[model samples]
Target: MEYSWIRLLVLVACLFPALVECRVRHYKFNVVLKNTTKLCSSKPIVTVNGKFPGPTLYAREDDTVLVKVVNHVKYNVSVHW
Candidate 1:
């Protein structure tokens, strides 16, 4: 019985690294405003990476997402998921 416990402890120690890992993903986003023409009108519009609707974020179960948003435009910025 004592030998069995020792074997179990060794098995768990070997598998610990495989079971625990850093599962976080990091992303950086820059927000800027530029004059764009739409519907025959020109105006400054808010954009994320130069896109109006921004980019899509993808994640999996038990995964963490870290986003850093930098504002370089003269507008109040807000991000929502």
Candidate 2:
């Protein structure tokens, strides 16, 4: 009897759909070196799309963001998110 109630609850939950608007946002980050003295004092520093601090990604609630990062610099970079 208890197992039947649990099964019914599971079936109902599975059949119920989420009532939320979901959207996919796409952004591309191009890693390159640019001449700037903001952070790095000496030579050119690695930046995203020629920006010093990179770009800001903004999305609404329940939004899925997809980022594509392309490295054009000679050195490998590991960006901490």
Predicted model with the maximum TM-score: 1
Estimate the TM-score for candidate 2.
0.65
Measured on C-alpha atoms, candidate 2 has an lDDT of: 0.87
RMSD of each: 6.9, 7.7
Task: Quantify all predictions' global Cα lDDT against the true fold.
Answer: 0.85, 0.87
Please, what are the lDDT tens digits per residue for candidate 1 over residues 26-80? 8888998868998999998888888878988777667899999999977678888
- Candidate 1 wrong stretches, greater than 4 Å: 1-22
Task: For model 1, name the residue pairs that clash.
Answer: none
Report the C-alpha lDDT of model 2 over 1-81, residue by residue, as the tens digit. 999999998888788746446789999999999876655576888999888788889998889999999999998998777
The count of backbone overlaps in candidate 2 is: 0
Q: Which stretches of candidate 2 lie over 4 Å from their true place?
A: 1-20, 37-42
Give the TM-score of each candidate. Answer: 0.66, 0.65
